[model samples]
Target: MTKVFRLKDLDCANCAAKMEHCLNKIDAINHVSVNFLTQKMVIEADENEFETVMQEVVKVCKKIEPDCKIIM
Candidate 1:
């Protein structure tokens, strides 16, 4: 399954890249991308595990940018 999320207050492009890298490392995710210019994130992962994967995604994002939020 694939989904796009709008990010709020994503501080920097480097952080976005880092989050993208971290998310793609997850076994359950097929792929992931973060576009700092647009403050958007795209996630492709197992449909059955999408929710759980997203929870992890949030954690990763939080660790990268505490003020950032994924508009679920």
Candidate 2:
């Protein structure tokens, strides 16, 4: 399944790129995008594992940018 989320406090384009890079490394993720300009994120993953993948995504995002939030 595919999902789009709004991001809060995403500081810079570089950070957004970092988030995208990390998220794409996850095995379950098929595609991911982090857009600093729009403050949004898009993720495509297996439907069955999406929730678990998102939990990991949140952790990854937090590690990179503590103040960043992905609105569920």
Best by TM-score: 2
Candidate 2 C-alpha lDDT tens digits along 1-72: 899999999998899999999999999999999999999999999999999999999999999999999999
Clashes of 1: 0
Give the top-scoring candidate (lDDT): 2
RMSD of 1: 0.7
Q: Per-residue lDDT tens digits of candidate 1, residues 1-72?
A: 889999999988899999999888988899999999999999999899999999999998998889999999
Query: Whole-model lDDT for model 1 versus the true structure?
Result: 0.92
Clash count, predicted structure 2: 0
lDDT of all predictions, in order shown? 0.92, 0.96
Worst 10 residues of 1 by lDDT: 19-28
Clashes of each: 0, 0
